[model samples]
Target chain A: MSTGPYNYSYIFKYIIIGDMGVGKSCLLHQFTEKKFMADCPHTIGVEFGTRIIEVSGQKIKLQIWDTAGQERFRAVTRSYYRGAAGALMVYDITRRSTYNHLSSWLTDTRNLTNPSTVIFLIGNKCDLEGQRDVTYEEASKFAEENGLLFVEASAKTGDNVEEAFLETAKKIYQSIQDGRLDLNAAESGVQHKPSQPGRNNLSNDQQANKDNCAC
Target chain B: MACLWSNSNEVLIQIPLTEEIDNVTFYQISVKVGEIKWNVKHRYSEFYNLHNQLITDHGVSKDILPSKKVIGNKSEPFIENRRKALEKYVQKIFIFLRQTMPKIFVDFLDFHLYDIYFLLQDLSLLCFTKGDLILSSSRVYSFKPIELYAINEFLKSPAPNFTNSSKQLDLGPILDLCSQLDAFIIHGCYNDYLKSNIILNKLPIDLSPFKIQKGLYLSNVSLDMVTSLGNARETVTTLEVVFSNVKRISDILQCDILHKNTLEESQKWKVLETLDLSNNNLMDIDESINLAKNLKHLILDNNYISTVSDLTQLPNLENLSIENNLITVCNDLHRKIGNIKTLNLSLNNIVTGKGFYKLYSLETLNLSSNKITNIEELECLGRLPCLEYLVLNGNNVSSSIDYRVKVLEFFGERAADIYLDNEKPSEAELDKVSILSALRIVKEGKTPDLSMNGSS
Candidate 1:
């Protein structure tokens, strides 16, 4: 048997959604690019990023879609909701409107994506503790009430940011291992790779294609 | 000039000029005359005449030969006869005007220019009415100045003739188009046609509302749409069916709207996990839970469900809440949900007894707002190796249960070690007489040696 970093074994599709100014784009940037973009313009339709991460000794590639936050743009961005393996339901800790709109956002996430999609509720901008509009206790209780995995994270400070993405990936990876998420299904948003020779060359070709197209 | 009259059979008369009038003016006057005569001098003195011509001439009528014309040709005998009649009536009026007034007739040529101008104006107004009729009937009028002027006048005038000019824009077609495109971004109030019709039926199965992207909000949807979505099994993952009066999930199970191969090709529904079907009028919970196999968390709060038997077989369920139901007992609940970590049975009528004894792995239990009146039954839960936080607020135990101190004393050491409520018992609170008395009983009696054995 031959092995060279074991070409990606699992591919997880993630979707980030929330109200405007909730820093969904920032959280995505911090997780995929590992750097904070302070002056990043708001998303117009949907932005995509991919990164290969190792979890449980398995190389998993996360395909994340960052969507526009405007209500009218939901028509254009909603198509990205299909085939998601993980969904980050983000809310701004400093804005109660963003917190209060969680149920509406949760309803959307529930109605659109597949059943295996891992929903992680993230209270973003946790560094703005002074202007906190939603108490951690209350948000945590809400997360419990809604049956969502929750955490208070800051993209600017990188606190719990990595944990949120990694936790979603771990949950998806676990689902694949458990056979709950079938890799052969069309909309499962997962692709399973069998251990084989010359798989790296095939992946490099795919990476090159990915570099050519901005999905 | 002379007056001419037509008889019933074939009599006719014509006017004749007395003097050889050179360059004479011809005046045409139309009058509505009857047996009762009204004064006409004041209205038409400038053109009317009574003392001009005194001559009459009659000619024998000639029958013309019929020409060989096409059957549909207008230049035939009948049309020619009607035209001759019209010319005779005009000539008679002109002759009568010349006969009535000699001086007025002499000056008529000078002021005759004014009559021709007014006659052309009347003809133009008549043409405008005809144009209006054509435009309204055919709707093919060119954008000419005259047509545009008439349309503007019709729009501005508050006449009832042009009713319904302010037609409402129909939204049914737009909604139908959006549904055909598989777009589910519904917002704002559409027209009545779109509001009542269920366009979800026409949408493709793959892009139906059940297959909509996650994190979408759909308000004011009908029961038909909800049922259509519920019937969509493998494609729909995370769904929050709210606001509508959905009484039974079985209504959704009957639609068979999902692709048959969706579940077999299980990768199609890989992303769906959480489903919130709360605040409905559901009395049974079996059908909704059976849709998604990978469902992890289920919230059935604020329903009329009296039993939890339907939720027993969900293997991956971690967080389950049947709070505010009418459940009176927790029979076989622990065995059914051996893997569940959080269970909320609050706001029910459960009595503190052996019903809650076997939840061995429960981490947090909320039994608040129940009629539990004693803490003795809580000793059964002490056997649960993982019980960490327990909310007994709003129950009758705080007031009627005198053994609260005794129950806390029995598990106080373990409870404090687990950091229950994030605090250790204070010295004064632990030294209370009620708690000390229970501790003395445990020390004197065999109490099963219930101390930490480092086995959990």
Candidate 2:
């Protein structure tokens, strides 16, 4: 394993979901790679990315799954929602259809994910001011009514992209600290890395299993 | 300045019609990025896969490309259509490659071996001399690679200009020059690909093999071992592991996952204080709720609870949300939630305020979207000393007899805390309301008949 010198104590699993063409992949790319990918092709089954982020002085690795937003792909994508700690429900600000489909997306998320999953509604493509079809206030009100954290972010400009991902991580971390999220639950989407470095030199198979357990 | 520099944004991708065997046209594409030209001969299906992969990996919008067809897809006309689409697709891909400058795409190009071999085959064909294949000579070679043949075809085509700054070029020497440049560039590209493969094999962090697992047992702990291993271990940071679409405890607790008296329940619900029994088929809270000793917030929204009788047993309950239920009356509800700070009973059948008079510590209450038609219900709510905020929107009582002023006068000094229809009475609005109340008291010697106009 190429883990850096400092040991990470936890790994958070996240899933990005929305209707097709809402920039879920772009948002993931922006958060993971810190660059806006303008012409990102549609996600097929699922795409994955990881970044080690710090929250409350803790270095947390975010394992994000970017799922295909196409409706037919939902059968394949639905399975990925099982252990997500956070779900970024995105909608394109330029397209009302994406926003209108939020409830359906939310239903899937709420139905499939654990109750403690932190769902953050993202109004993407905020950079396209002229083409905006959804207002921030309306989306925020929708978020408030649905009990979701809301933010207007532009993946192209990288505006609030960092905050959206980081905020979800922070909320999940808070839940862990508050003990709302059970670390040992099979589907809690949280893994507590036991702080024992002495037993780190185990056989390769055991070491691999230990690492997989931390995902 | 950025707009003026568009002319310098050079892209040189070679598309050659490599074959026409059995009427299935194949294009050998050599896409040049910097000094390395990645060459690949692909049929339409491979192009489709490439396009789809590009879309998935990069999130590129597919709006500009032609829609795919399934009927008669293998016919010559359809193949020709796909070939045209492929040309546009490659151009767009190059455009994206130029703009994003992603290292992964470059690696992806190098990783696919057939493209490199195709380019090498074209180079060796041009080399003519057998010994020169092994010769590490940097000298310029002869005929331009077959990949550039498509560029000449494009130049000869009668299509409209793809770019604004279009210029005509002499094809003869350009082809020669491109061919000569291909020898050294092709050699260098192959070397880099081989060298990187060696380095990649040597590295301890190749995680592609063990990363993907289909079963939940395998996926539960699988890390993006690639990124995690590469990340520097600075401070032992805390990680939040979220499994996707795991059955929530609400369903799991009521059904299969956790059995009673298992090690699972104690651990899972150890610090679980709030339990959401909302939108379930629950008729009422049973004795099972008493098990949650530390439970404070209990949400039973959208259920079938008819009364607040079952809630009295929750020893430490503070916030209760039982909205969208069949609750018709709340007679002495305070006896059950006397110390509760917040209560939400919206979207219910609550018709009277008889149960709320004694909730002295309750600060916030939501009674919206109910059948409350009796203005007298405000008196029961007004008596609660700690009641700071209240919502009664969508109730029949709200549309009766100056509802805001009447409610404000009833709340007295706490009128400023009243939230009617989500609108809190401002200081000025409340002051006016109180003055009107004082005038009415002085003029009439009693409160106005604030009852519903006719019914109830």
Candidate 3:
């Protein structure tokens, strides 16, 4: 039944992680709901939001998990880090303290998620040029030193938000096309779906659904 | 590098056991590099070939590999001894020629298992074919994680000046120079950047142009009875219409496109599967949501609803999340959304577990951040046969002493089955549960089970 003309071909599990009030849920709202939540509640626990996206001509369903960013919720949020194909680590550009916690967040991400999980570093609230605390060049340098994709996006303005999520998918999709990430691996964080009818070969990242039901 | 699970790029070659096939012993090399783990088996002859090549081709003269015992080499003791020595040999090559890791040795460990090897080979050939005019930043390498690990290797490498390793694929010098570098960067570094570039100088990619946009995401607009589910595409299967007005699910069905001849007789819900209506102000669990009988997953989180009422019409509701609702009681929840496998009621005002009386198919229940204060509230959960994962974080009883043990005690022999607060009962907790079960038996004056040491 997934062979519908426009059904997505892959589901990539993504986890959005960062410090408290760094706009983790806001970024998810801006990406999926396409609007800013000025009164977004501080997340009580993990929240689920998904948006289907396209990368390299392939339809990919992004099952994004937005977790509570408070330190007290670390135990609950830590469980969400596993099996993530992409991790968006957000930090407030206006708060130097939030930027200082990057190393701690990076350690958790590198430890919990698999090795191939793409980590995208985002400097949220870039629209607040007046209260800017973290410089773009320093964060860019940090991203270059560490192996992470970097972007300065404002969830309120919706600037570079789509690109951060999509570029991570593009790299993940390319990994699939090139065979770096094996779908058979449990920790690969990707599920293959039967492509729509007449979409071409079953090779490359395209494989029949595990149930193998052609309908 | 401070990660607890995967050691950073430390190659661990564990030869725990060996296999014998057709009188030839194969030593299994269980290899683990950081988070990547794989297995490669090799016979003694293959080891000898790798050892010979390491010395002859790569100039590795330190041949400390166990001496070849052609006679009785297949014996038990000999295979055992060779297993240990072969492990040492592989580890030595990994540590010795780590900087200029020869291709023969890299192949021995299967480090080049991915398409990255082939792509790097293509880049190496290109750099060799062309002169060193272009910068390494001009071309991009596929692997990003390896690029970071390669930094430490590139810096520690005694001779970082590896120029145009045209020996085909550059798997050795590339991976050895901390693999997956901008070939131009490495070569260009050899000529220019190496002397002048700072330590943190890695290629930066501008990802703005890669704005990912494939499917339709509802733009900034409030949903109405007309524009909410009404305007959904004919082929759309998933609908995420949130931050909307108009109470009752029946209103969403008022869209002309959704209702075929009439609202109740609509087959348009056939193609629709998952619907997310979070952040809505609703007072009722209108039965029309079940009009789409095939709807399996429904998320109604962050609503102003008070009860788990009116969801019985959904025949295939497998997964449901009503996380942030105003439901203070759950006495008849199973009667409403009963056979669903996964349920999330975290951050609610549920006081008792009796509502979960007969959810036989419930496997994962997340009731974290709720207001259940009493330890007896969990006793009601012992009836559900399939309740395996029960999360209770932020609840009052979770902070009580022996909270995990008291909860595990209720499961009795199935204590190991239940996962309290998203974590399974540890070995000590399971032992305590067993002891508690035995104590209860003794107090009741019943005969002790044969598994215990108590005399009947």
| Most lDDT-accurate candidate | 3
* Top of the candidates by TM-score: 1
Summarize candidate 3's per-residue lDDT along A48-107 as a digit string, tens digits. Answer: 666778765567878777878887667546655666899999999999999999999999
In order, how many clashes per candidate?
27, 47, 5
Give the docking tier of candidate 2: incorrect
Q: Of the candidates shown, which would achieve the greatest DockQ relative to the real structure?
A: 1
User: Docking quality tier of candidate 1?
Assistant: incorrect
Q: What is the lDDT of residue B173 in candidate 3?
A: 40
TM-score of chain A of each: 0.87, 0.89, 0.90
Task: Compute the DockQ of candidate 1.
Answer: 0.02
Model 1, B1-456: lDDT tens digits are 000111112212221211112432222222212211111111112222221121222121222212323354343454445334433633454454432322233233221111212222233444445545543464222222122222223234343221223322122332222223221333212223221221322222222322343422333334453323432344445555544345765443333444332233322234446665567787867544454546667776787888776453354566677788787776646434534557788887888746656544356777778788777766676555445666666777756544444445545444332323334445454566335655576788856332232111
Better of 1 and 3 by TM-score: 1
TM-scores of the candidates in the order shown? 0.36, 0.33, 0.36
Q: Judged by lDDT relative to the true structure, which candidate is superior, 2 or 3?
A: 3
**Candidate 2 lDDT over residue span B215-306, tens digit each:** 01111222221222111111111111122122322232332224444433333332335555454456666544544544567777766677
As for lDDT, the candidate ahead, 1 or 2, is 2
